[model samples]
Structure formats: C-alpha cells, structure tokens
Target: MKLLCWNIRGFGFTGRRRQLIEYLRQEEIDIVGLQETIHQDFSMHELQGLSRHQFAWQWLPSTGQSGGIFLGVREDVFSVEDMDRGEFFLSMSVTDRRVHFSWEVIFVYGPADHARSAGFLAEPKNKVERCTTPVVVAGDFNLISWASDKSSPNVDRVRMRLFNDCIADLALRHEGLGANLGADLRARKGALLDQIKVLDDLDDGQGLCPDGWLRRYALESSLMDIYKSEELFWQRRGGQNWLLKGDANTAYFQAIANGRRRKCAIPFLWDGDVLLESLEDISTHIYSFYKELFSAEPRGGVSLCADFWPLADQVSDAENADLTLPVFPEERMTAPWLRNSVKRLVRYFQLGASAATPLLQCSDRAGRPP
Candidate 1:
C-alpha cells in the first residue's frame, strides 16, 4: 500500500488546489495525510473537488488561520472503521481489502506554540500504548530531529527536547529524506515536486543513462555521507561519547543527538532573575557576582582551637621521616603495567582527537571558536 504525507500549507489558492488534485490523480495515492489546510469548514463542492479519485477524507479544521489536520483514504482500496479528530490531529483505524491488513494512522498537525505542540505529540504515545494495532504516525511535526536539521546556528533546546523525548519514549521509527535536503526543500514545494518527478521517472527506468545513473548514485552517496557527518558533528559538539557506528543514520539517532544537544545547552542562569536568555550577558553577570561573593570578607567569628602545638608529641623523628618518604621509587613509574595503562590512555585520547579533528576544522573555517 502507498501512503503520501504532505504539509500543503493551505488549500486557499486555486493554483495550489489544482496542483494538489493533479498530483493526487497522477500518483494514484492510496492514503494521504495533509496539514495546515487553514480552513475551518469544507463545503460540499470543496470536498468533491478534493476527492478526485473517490477518496473520502476527515478533517480537523484550523483554529482561525493556524492549525489543521487532514486524512484521506481511497474508498476502493480501504475501509475506515473508526475516526477520532482533535485540534491538532486526525486519527483513523483502517483495513485494506487487498491484503485484509488493519492498522491505525494518526495524522498530526502540531501547533506552532511549543506547549501545545508538546501535548499534541504526547497524545500519539498514549494512543500507541493503549491500542493493539500497529500505528503509523505521520505529519508536519514542526520539529526537527537534530541540531543540523536546519541551517541555523541556534536551536530551540526545550522544544527539541520534548519532540525527541516523545519519539524515543514511544520507540517510533522515523523514515524520510535526508536532513539537508529536507531542510533545503522545506520552503520550496516546487523543487520538492521536481524531486518527486525525478524519483518516479527513475523508478520506471525511463530516464538517465548509465553515466547519469552513476552521477546520481555518487550524489546520493555524498549526500548520505554529509548527512551522517553532520549528525556526528552535532553529537560531538553535544559532548556525546558514543560513536554513531555503521548505518546508524536513522531519525532515531538524529533525535537522540538533538536531545543530547538540548541537554548540553545552558537553558537558563541563576542571575538574580530566575532565567537569563543572553549567554554572554549571563556569563558576565555570573562571573562578576561570584567573584565578589568569593572575595568578600567574613564577619566576626569564634575560633574553635585555643592554641597551636608541635608534632613532637605525636611521633618520633624517625617515624615522621618514614611517614614523609615517597611511596614509590622513580623507576616504579616505568613498570610494564603502569606503562601499558598510560599508553592505552594516550591511544584512546589520540583516537578521540582524530575523530573530532574534522569538526574542529569545520568550526574554524566557519570563523567560530571550537
């Protein structure tokens, strides 16, 4: 069975609506989940227009202009058993007649507001825990799985934490395009359409020569490498000790690395005010406050000891001398065990250093301190 998910942003524009209908008809998609329809109500005419291929749909309308969720299923292919709709999601239980297989699908449109989004994300986990059927949760989460999911240097640590925690706690498997391409194409649906066309053509074996195929393969391989490298870079920046190793380039690991970065961030500071947002300002404020705090003189205090005494009463000169003697000989440091331990530590350090050297160089090239 084929499933297509897209955040169409809105269906208000006639051109976009036509494009969507055309795409749906051309692809002959069996199931689709759409987000940000931006319409509070769908008229009969609108429903007829959207259900071009006899697909039935359920929608959770937007609150004013902000949020909407939609799910559509081809009537000839599957039968919908139950549906539940909310402000942020539209879920349905469906069975495909072709295979007699049934599953639950949760189509989500997470709110732009972080708090609401957190609650919306958690609902699926709860649903999965309670339901016996296999569930496929899909939508525009408005949350990235890694720090490198976007090109921005700064990341929303709190929101990312909540997002990643939800995914991990539920053990959900995330499958999609590479992070770089996803971020790049996020705002350009036209480019995304072109990519889809290319893939379709390639699947039909109707486009590109052996050389072109080789180039495409090389390009994909390079993109995958870069994606994995970026993930590793962020992992290292977040002070993670574990290596990604092998083909661990899935969204689960990316979410994990993003969560680690969030935790590693300085969320807030205890500067008189409970939380300070500016890192540099907070650093300066904390440094000055602590410096003065440590430098301040103490007030009057009572002394616990009455007087001082010599150590002669506690030990003889020979005993004192013996106690002061060094515990090991100078040559003892050269023992095989000690030498081996030190060598092992050095080797480990070198391995880690080598692994991190590329990240350091990249940071330097970007004119950022490592």
Candidate 2:
C-alpha cells in the first residue's frame, strides 16, 4: 500500500497539474493525507473522480475558521468511514479486506499563532509514546525536523536532536521502509516543515540511495491511460510548481523563507507535475500510519471564539475572510476561512451534526447575495 503525503499548497494550476498527473500516473499511490486544504467545501470529487481511483474524502475545520485537512484512498483496495469532527479536525477509517484491521487517519492544520503550539509537542510525544500500531503522521508541521531523514549523508545538530527526542518521547516504533533518500531529497538542501514517520515498521531493509529515486522502486497503481490523461488535464495553473515549471522556480521558495518576500496568493507547489490534489495539497506523507490505532485529539469547540467570526456576507471583509471567492483564492487568509466553513458545514451534515447548526445561516466567507 504505497501512500503519498504532501502539502500540495494549492489546486490551481495547468502545467504543474500535468506534471503531477504524470507522476501519480506513474506512482499509483494509495492513501493521501493533506492539510491547509484552503477550500470552503471539502468535496469528495477530487478523489472520487480522480483519474480511475475510486475514493472518499472528508474536510476538517479549524478554530479560527480558515484551514483544515482531507484524506483520500483508492476505492478498490480500501473502505472509508467518515469521522466528522468538522469543528477542529477531519478523519476517516480505511480498511483492507485481507486484514479486517482498520485505522483512523487525521488531517491537521496547526494553529500558527496559538498557545497550544507552545505546549503540544511533548503532549503528542507522550501520547504516541505508548502507541504500538501502524501510524503514519505527515503535514507541514511548521516545526522544523533535523533537515534530513536516516538516508541523509549527515544529520544536522538541531535536526538530529529534535528527531531523537521525538522518538524517545513518542516511543515511536520505526521509520517506514524507504530508499532513505534523505540527502538526495534535499539535494539542493534547504527544506522546512515537512516529515513522515511510520510506527510498527522499520526501513524496508533498503538503506538510503544517493538520489530520492527510490520512489521509482515502489509499485504504482495510479497510472490511468497516459494518453487520455494528457488530453483531459484541465489544470489551470500552468506555471505554479516552480520545480517543474519555469516561472514557479525555487528562487521564490527561498525568498519566502529568507523573509526576502511576503506571502502572495502564490502557492508553494504549483505545477502540472504536481497534481493540485486538495488533500495532498494540504497534507503529506505516511497517511496510513494512524488509520487504525494511534490517537490524540483537539481541545474541542470550547476553545473557539465563534462570536469573533463574521456573517458570510460580512466575511468578505471578515477579519476580512472568504472561501472559493474568485477575488483572492490565492491568498491564504481568505481562502482557508471560507474553505473550512464550507467543509465544516458539509461535514456537519455528513456526520449528522445537530440540526441546530443550520447551513442556511452560513455564508461563503465572502458574503454574497442571498
């Protein structure tokens, strides 16, 4: 079961989308966990109609009402169970028929400016410390990992200690089987806020390879007819990936980190080579890790200041927020606000949330004509 966890950044692109289709077509990945989906309604269409993969998806909302996560699994191999906690998180269970074993998968959108961020690393470390099951955790953690995985030529001082402590604290079982493309992965070096850990499994015996090419060795199921896909690529953002596309180059990525630039509606990864998978766009890596056993949770609706939120119409300037609004889909603040609202409301219905949470009162972060 090959799973791809990624922070796709955004789903707007044409060229980058093509490149993504090309890769996934070759990768045929299974579970994809995402975060910062930045969409109002977390629709299942991205997965349900994704190429030939039959799947289910769920979107979780954040306390500030601006972001969340979604997960997708190939329908043929797994079964899905929606865990609707639209208020703070999104989750689902995927089961394989051969082994009735099932796991819960959670998509998280970390609070950028919250007190919880200060105290929760150890909390999860302690929480997962006793865990003994398949758990795949991936996302743009915002926290920095030692800059390299086991396959790295050498571990950095800061990165090494952080990972070691996590292992000791989480009592995590093992790193997933890998080509250990650590050094190869950061060939250009300079990566922040992304990592994947698998419990109950150690390196699949293959040590690190010189390049991250080990992905080539994995079995791929996503390959739908290449010819047909090339013809159907409806990708709109052609120059976003910067990696594969000429315009969205790494220079811009560096600028963002160096503080040489400010946030743009531009996404981190936007290219045809990188399909703007809403779930994958937000979450990345080890998606199947917690499908069944590991468990840690959000504080709940009690922590949210629901009153601070603007009415859908008032949302246009809502703290100045809005979702799926054409005005600024590229802007992080606006899109996430509306995306999660829609996701929260939709999920509220899907999970059979109390009828009191009336969807009618809800407005797309940017209030529109009723």
Candidate 3:
C-alpha cells in the first residue's frame, strides 16, 4: 500500500495534470490526497468521471466555505466514513473482517493561513492517542517537520512550537515515509526551492514516516507542480495532492471545492494572451497522455515491483528479465494503485479548470505574482 501527496495550486491546470496521472502510473500508488481544491458544487464533481477507483472530495467554499479536503480510494479497499462536513478533515476507512485487520485513512488539507493551522492540526494529534484503530494521516501539515529546522529560513517558531507540542502532547508516531524531505538547492539546480519535503530522518516518535527499508519511496509524488513559479510552487501557494496509503477505504465521494459565483476559483489556460477555449480539452489531454504512457505492457521482463524500484532489480536479475514482463498498471484498474491515481486526475481538472478554459492557476486571486 502506497500513498502519494502534493499541493498543486488551484487544482485547475488540466494541461500539466497528466504528469500527476502518469506519476501515479509510474509509482503504482494506492490512496491520493489533494489540497487547495478550488471549485464550486457542480464544478467540484469531477472525480466521478475517472476510471478505476471510487473517490470522495470535501470542497469547502472559499467565498463562504473554507477550501480544502480530498480523498480517493481504490476499488478493492471498501470505503466507509465518506463525509463532506465543510471542514478541513475528511475521513475514510477499509476493514478486513477475516484477518481482523482494519485501517482508517484521513486526507487533511490543513490551512496555510497562519491563523487556521493550529486548532485543526492539534485535534487530530490528540485523538490518535486513544483511537483503537491504526490511523494514517497524510497531506500537507503546513508546518515544517521538526527535522526541517536544519537550515535556511527558519520554520515559523510559533508553528514549529505548536507542532512540537503535538509531538509531545499526542505522542503520535511518525509514519510519513518522508517523501518530500529531499527538497533543496542542489535538487533544484542551485535554487532553494524544491516543493517536496525530502527529510533524512523518519519519525523517531511513534512511526509516522517510512524510513530505513522505505528509501526509494521518498521520491514518488501524488501532486503536480505545473507552474514553475518558485514561490507559488514551493513553500507558498502552489498546487499539491497529499496521499494516504496503508489500508484505505473503497470509493466514496467528497466535493473538492464549492464556491459562489464570480469569486469562484478558476484554472485559466492561455496561448500567450488568448485564453484557452475549453476545459474539456484538458480532460482529453490527460487521457491522451495516459494512453501514451501505458499503451503497451511493461518492458524488459521484470517483476512488477522490480519495474517500479531499482532496489527490486534483484527480482528481475539474470533470467527474470527474459521471463514474465512486469505490469506497470493503469489508473483504471480495480486495484488500489490504479483507482486512487485516476480519480485524483479526474477531480483535479474538473474542479481546477473552468467550464471552458485551460492552463491551471488561480487567475482570480488578486496580486497573484506572474
């Protein structure tokens, strides 16, 4: 079970969304979580169209509703607790009666606004202590990991302090897998802005992030950074989707974003100055990209895991490469990896893009730097 996450700005850029979809294809992900979903009711329902797994979104209105929350579940997982309370946290669960194995999943789009990050992040930390079931929380914490304090602009002390408080207060385990901790100037080619947080340390606390044996997974991305704007894409307001794997639920539903008229967030695509004519085109673009990537079977005969991981090359060494061809998988498959990926892409375009536009970003957000 693999979870992928990222915060792609606005969720509207359908053009670059295929990269996210293909990422899922490449990583063979299970559950996917997204943040900053900007859309209204009808516009927010884009998740249903995607193939493979069932999806749920919690699109709180930005105008009157707070924006955030999205969860996509694989078909085999058996989803339960799908709710759209117009809150920052959205929930889902999967259980195996026979094995007595169960898991509860949460995709939280915590507020980046300094004022909002506190209460939301704390409550969860406190609850995990007593919950009988194993809970995996993924998505942007909006706060730097305590390990992120190594260099550069110091993480906000108040926020950092609050996060540390949670660590002690809740005694929550760190199960993050530390996928985004690798962001650095070298990784960004001399720039100090790689959006993902690639941390070297795993949670020494409980067991939040994966470490040691889970090193290769530190690079998979569920979110796509279409706009190269360093500020927008990296630490500030870029687009991203946070995924929570483990025992995820079956397909349920949540609206990514629902706003009123005019102020509604829009994903505008343009040719220099000419605005894109249709959002429908964005969907087509994703489908085409997917076809190109997965049109054929896996190459260089290898085990499915081997095809995904260089570490797994042992499984494909010697004669195995000449044996069975590994499966890279499609997002439309009944399995967790496929359904989770495909659904995220579908909702991304619908909620992110306009009814008739392309290019992805919050063009309506005033003072948005070009």
Which predicted model would earn the best lDDT?
A: 1
| Stretches of model 3 off by over 4 angstroms after superposition | 24-27, 42-45, 56-66, 81-86, 96-100, 126-130, 147-151, 176-370
Give per-residue CA lDDT, model 2, range 1-370, as digits (tens): 5666666554434554455455556788777666655545544544444446666655554334445566676768777743433333445566654333466554445555544543435544543443344444555454434455436565455644654577556544334443233332232122111111221122444544533223322211122222233333323222334446453447755665566445433334444475554646534422444443466665666432445434542223332233223344454457666576667455445533343243234455563411
Write the residue-wise lDDT of candidate 3 on 105-158 in tens digits: 766666757797788776666556545676767676667666464487656777
lDDT (CA) per prediction: 0.68, 0.47, 0.50
RMSD of each: 29.1, 37.0, 37.9
Per-residue C-alpha lDDT of model 1 across residues 1-370, encoded as one tens digit per residue? 5687888888787887888787777888788888898878778788777655777788887888777777888879888888877656788888765334578888887777765776777676777777677788888888887898979978888888888888878866665553344343332334334544575588688777776555455445545555675676566644532443423777767787798999888857776656687888778887988899899687567532322223332334453333233334443546764665465445435445434233222222332212
Worst 10 residues of 3 by lDDT: 218-227
TM-score of 2: 0.37
User: What TM-score would every model get versus the actual structure?
Assistant: 0.47, 0.37, 0.41
Candidate 1 vs 3: which has more TM-score: 1
Which model is ahead, 1 or 2, in terms of TM-score? 1
lDDT of 1: 0.68
Worst 10 residues of 2 by lDDT: 191-200
In model 1, where do residues sit more than 4 Å from their true spots?
178-370
User: What is the overall TM-score of model 1 with all chains considered together?
Assistant: 0.47
Error of 2 at 205 (Å): 35
Ranking of all predicted structures according to lDDT, beginning with the best and ending with the worst:
1, 3, 2
